[model samples]
Target: MLYDLFWQPFADFAFMRHALVGCLALALGCAPIGLFLVLRRMSLMGDAMSHAILPGAAIAFIAFGLSLTAMSLGGLLAGLVVVLAAGAVTRSTQLKEDASFAAFYLVSLASGVLLVSKWGNNVDLMHILFGSVLAVDDMALCFLAGVASITVLTLAVLYRALVVESFDPEFLRATGGGGAWAHFGFLILVVLNLVAGFQALGTLMAVGLMMLPAASARLWARELPAMLAIALGIALLSAYIGLLLSYHADLPSGPAIILTAGLAYFASLGLGRHGGLLGRWLRGRHLEA
Candidate 1:
């Protein structure tokens, strides 16, 4: 039964294949970064940065028409600028990271909306906001593959510095390595993944793709390496299940994928053995008797 449903979609429709492949690439690229973002308490930063891409995307569309490659590059640059500026503002002022992020994201979102309205072309707005995974073409797929490869390679090469800087920047500095550079590099990776993902997931939910699986994994794992593995597994599973659901239900792929990740998060919260609601409830019952 299951094979019958998925076989037609996979074999007959090129769009279905594109969507599945694109989502898988997003999963792999996002999982590790998501885990680190959670560890560094920068999950909100990821969210902020995702939304900050909207203005850039709108401007790119206005200037050069609906060119996916150009818009992706423009969005990437905008996200990077916002994140860097937020970091600088936080370091130089008394405002917290979350505060800076919230402020910037709101401003960017409003500006993006206004720009799109001023351009007087409302045709592609839906694509920018909600995403159109079924519209993925060969060029977009190639771009996604390249971005994913670069992101993975950079993370592998900088793994040690990233780990040290994430867990203990002071110790990394004491060991004669500059933690700031590592942080900057990690932020760049985050921007790249966000841009790559935007093509399928849109700016609104791009950060959710990066965050939910990793957050779910944290509920079950105690160590960073284990958490990373679990996060990756969860991300992949969510992508597969989400794609199937979207195919069957005729729903939007991005939201379906995000909802699948959210379901995993809730399952982890409720049933995980380490510190879930069920675990706490069982312990309480045993103690009461």
Candidate 2:
């Protein structure tokens, strides 16, 4: 029963195998990016970029009729534009970054919805918004793999600079470091991963995969390296169990994976050793004793 429920789906179906591979790749790529976002309090920024890519993807679909390369490039350009515009709006105007991000993402979301409605069919829109993981082709797989490789290597190369910039941008700059470059590089990685994630999880929920595991890890781990490692493990486990559930229970794969991550986050909230609800309660009881 266990094999039938868990292993058979993947073993029997090529699509299932492909989906598993894609989710694993997403976990590998997005988890680290997510840890940084959580640490920097930019979880919402990841969500914004996910949504911001939608209009560009929609435009690409309209122009090229579902060409993966075009849509990916368009999404990348759109994310970059939103990042730049939001930064400019925050720095040049009096608006805060969050407010500017909100403005930009909302506008992008509306534009995407309108474009999809006007130029595309429900099938196309559904695929873009909710994703069709079972339909992942060779091209999509290559794209996802490339993004994962790039994200991992880039994070490794700039690990120290990113850490310093995240914690002390002012200090980094004062010490004659390229904090701005690190920030931009990190944002670019975020965008790239979001685009890759959109292929499997869709625009609406791609950031969920990134943020949820990272947030859960935050509750359980104290150090950055521990958090990153824990986040990656949680993400991979979520993907594995989520795929099984999606197969046996007939759930949406993307949402299933994301909801599994959510469960981990909530579980960590209660049971994590670092600062969990149970941990704090136990400490309190010990103090009273």
Candidate 3:
């Protein structure tokens, strides 16, 4: 029964094996970026970038006829454009950061939808919007693995600068610490991971894998390193269980994974030891006594 429940599907199908490997790579690569997004209160920013990248991929598909490299480059450029334009607007105008991001992404999303509608069939559109993880090819797997490797190495190299910028940007800048470069570098990493994730989970769901696990971990871990570790672990668990649920329940793979992460988030919200509702209520009751 245990083997049937857990190992049978993967053993019987190559696609399941590939999906598991892809999820593992994503959990390792995207979770840390999601942790930083939560810590810096930039969850919405990730969402906006995810949406913004769609138009680029759409254009690439329209022009190059489903070339993965073209679409990835297009998506990367679109994400970077949105980040730069939003950041510039936030710094130069009275518009706040989130508002600026919202403006750009809304425009990008609309444009992407229009482009997809005009140039591609519904199947192509669905592939871009929801991904085809079950149909992942060797090239896609290689790309995913490469992105994960690069992300992990880059984060390790820039850990201290990113930590300082997250908690104390003013201090980092005042100390001549190249905070702007660090910030740009971080944003680039976010874009890269999103582009990589887009191939597996679609743009709409990619950010969920990153943010949901990070948010859930935030409820439990007080320290940065702990939060990153917990978030990665939660993400990996969610990916595995989500795949199992997808196979058994006949659910959409991407959303099943995201919903699993959402489940973890809600569970953390209520039962977490550090900042959960139960913890708060317990402290309140103690105070009353």
Candidate 4:
């Protein structure tokens, strides 16, 4: 039963093996970033940024067809542009950072759709909108793994600064610790991961993988380290379940993976030990009794 359910699928298909590895890499890189995003109450930023990269990718697609280098470069450039422009708007106007991000992403999303629908075919648009892990080639897998490795290393270096800034930016700034650079670096990492992930999960569902597992972990852990670990576990498990569902049920791979994460999030909401609704209610009843 185990082999048929788990091992057989992978053993039977090379695409399955490749997809599993890609998902593993994505989870490893995105989970910690997702956790930090949640802690900072900037969860939607992931979604926004995902969309914000679409225009560049779409333009690159129009200009260069399916060239991976062009797509990556275009997406990175577009994401950085949005990030910087949003920062400028925040600094120069009364609008908050989130508001600025929201405005920019809306424009970016619309522009991307317009470009793709106008210049590209349905297949091109679909690929850009919803990625196919089954299509992950050797080069794509290497890209995913490299992004994960860099993300892990960068996060390790920035962990202390990130934690401090997430909780209290003023505190990080007051100590002459170059919190600005850390924040910029973190944003760069976020864009890099999203750009890499968009190839496998697509723009629409990429943030779901990043956010859902992290949100689920948030309900189960009080400490950052614990939350990070829980999110990683959930992400890995969701990726496996999602890949199996995609393979067996003929569902779209990206949505299947994200739906698995959604399941974990709901389960945590109801049954998780820390700060879960059930746990909170049970404790309240016990205290009253």
Candidate 5:
């Protein structure tokens, strides 16, 4: 029974194996970026950027007819445009950063839907909005793995700058200009990972995998290294269990994985040691005793 439920799907089907690997890659690549996003209080930013890349992919689809390279480049360009425009506005105007991000997110999402509707078929639109991980081939797996490697390497270089910027940007700025470059480089990493993930998980659901695990880990951990470890572990577990759930229940792979991550988030919320409700209750009982 255990073998049938837990292990047979991947053994029987290559698609399941591919999807399992792809989801793991996505989780690995997205966790650190997501954690930093939460640390910087930019949880919504991931969602915004995910949608922000859609129009670029849509344009590429219209022009290049479903060419992956074109769509990837277009999406990267589009994401960078929004990031630059939003950052520019935040620096130049009275608008707060979240508001700037929100404004661009709405415009980009609406425009993407409109463009895809006008030029592409419903199938194309669905593919962009909700990617099919089950369809991931070896080439796609390579892309996801490559993105993960690049993200890990980039974060290692940017680690000190980003952490310092997160806790004390002024201090980092006082020392040198590394903070500025680090900030920009971090944003680029965010967009890069989002673009890579969007191809497998869809724009809407990609950030779910990214942000949910990080947020959940935040409730459980206080230190950055611990948080990153917990988040990556949660993402990987969710990917594996979610794929199994999808296989047995005939559910969508992306949403299933995200839902599993959501389950983890809620579980963390209730039972986390940092400030979870259950932990607080337990502490109260101990005090009374």
Candidate 6:
């Protein structure tokens, strides 16, 4: 029965195929970035940036009249601007990083919503909020693919510096690598991923995909590489399974995908041997004897 439901749709429909491929691409691109974000304790920054893209998207719609390419580019630029501005503010002022991020994103979010409301295009807001993967066209797919490739390549080249800076910026500075710029570059890549993911996952949950699997991987792995590999594996698995479920169950693709990733996170929290709650409980019981 399950095979009939799943295989028949893929065999018969084009949209399902697009959704599956698109989601997989998103997972591959976003998961590794998620690992670094989690390690750097900047998960909330992802959330802020996701919301911050709204106004840019809204303005793009108003100015360019619903050109997806224009809107996406505009939103991407907005996200990068916010990231840089946040950094500048944090460095030049007394505000902490989190405080700066919160202020910038909240203001951006509110401005976007207000502008969209004023422009009388509330319908587009749904697309900005929840996404519609089934609506993805060949152009969007190609764009996502390019963004994914660039994101993965950038991360690969900068992996060592990012890892070092994440763990110990002082050590990196001592080694004369200019850890600050490296850190800045890493965040720029993250902002790009968040922008790319906005189309597939939307503002409400784009960062969810970027954070949950990496968070889950942390339960079992101590080293950064192992954690990243495990996170990527879990993310890919979630996308495949979630797409299948969405196909058979006729659910919204993005949220279904996110829920699948969330389940993996919860399972890891419970069953992981390193620090999982279940593992700890079992060890305690065993030691009581």
Candidate that beats the other on TM-score, 1 or 3, i.e. the better one: 3
Candidate 6 per-residue lDDT, tens place, 1-289, comes to: 8677657776678987887777778878888988888888888888998887878888987888757697798888888888889989999999999999899999999998888778756677777777777887898788878878988898888888888888887899999876887787787877777777887877787888889999999998998879988999898888778877887788888899899999999999999867899999999999997
Report residue 109 deviation for candidate 1 (angstroms). Answer: 0.7
| Model 5 residue 262 CA deviation in Å | 0.1
Looking at candidate 5, what is the lDDT of residue 266?
A: 96
Candidate 5: segments with Cα more than 4 A from true spot: 285-289
- The residue pairs that clash in candidate 5, if any, are none
Report every candidate's CA lDDT. Answer: 0.87, 0.91, 0.92, 0.92, 0.91, 0.84
TM-score of each: 0.95, 0.97, 0.97, 0.98, 0.97, 0.95
TM-score of 1: 0.95
Give the winner by lDDT: 5 or 6. 5
State residue 65's C-alpha deviation in candidate 6, in Å. Answer: 3.4
Once model 5 is optimally superposed onto the true structure by TM-score, how far is the C-alpha of residue 212 displaced, in angstroms? 0.5
Worst 10 residues of 2 by lDDT: 130-139
> Given candidate 3, what's the lDDT at residue 204?
89
The backbone clash count of each candidate, in order, is 0, 0, 0, 0, 0, 0
Q: Which candidate is the best by TM-score?
A: 4
Candidate 5 local Cα displacement, residue 276, angstroms: 0.8
Off by over 4 Å in 2: none
| Candidate 5 per-residue lDDT over residues 154-257, each given as its tens digit | 99999999999999989999999499899888889889888888878888888998999999999998999999999999999999999999888999988999
lDDT of 2 by residue, 1-289 (tens): 8788779999999999999998899899999999999888888988889999999999998999888899999899999999999989999999999899999999999999899999888888888998877778888888888999999999999899888887888899999788888888999999999999989989988998899999999998889999999999999999999998888889989899999999999999999988899999999999999
lDDT (tens digit, per residue) of candidate 3 on 1-289: 9999988999999999999898889889999999998888999999999999999999999999878789999999999999999999999999999999999999999999899999899988888998877777777788889999999999998899999988998999899998888788999999999998999999889999999999999999899889999999999999999999999999999999999999999999999989999999999999999
Please state the error at residue 125 of candidate 1 in Å: 2.1
Residue-level lDDT of model 4, residues 1-289, one tens digit each, is 9788877889999999999999999999999999999998999889999999999999899899987789888999999999999999999999999999999999999999999999988898889989888889898899999999999999999999999999999988999878989888999999999998898999888898899999999999898899999999999999999999987898998999999999999999999988899999999999999
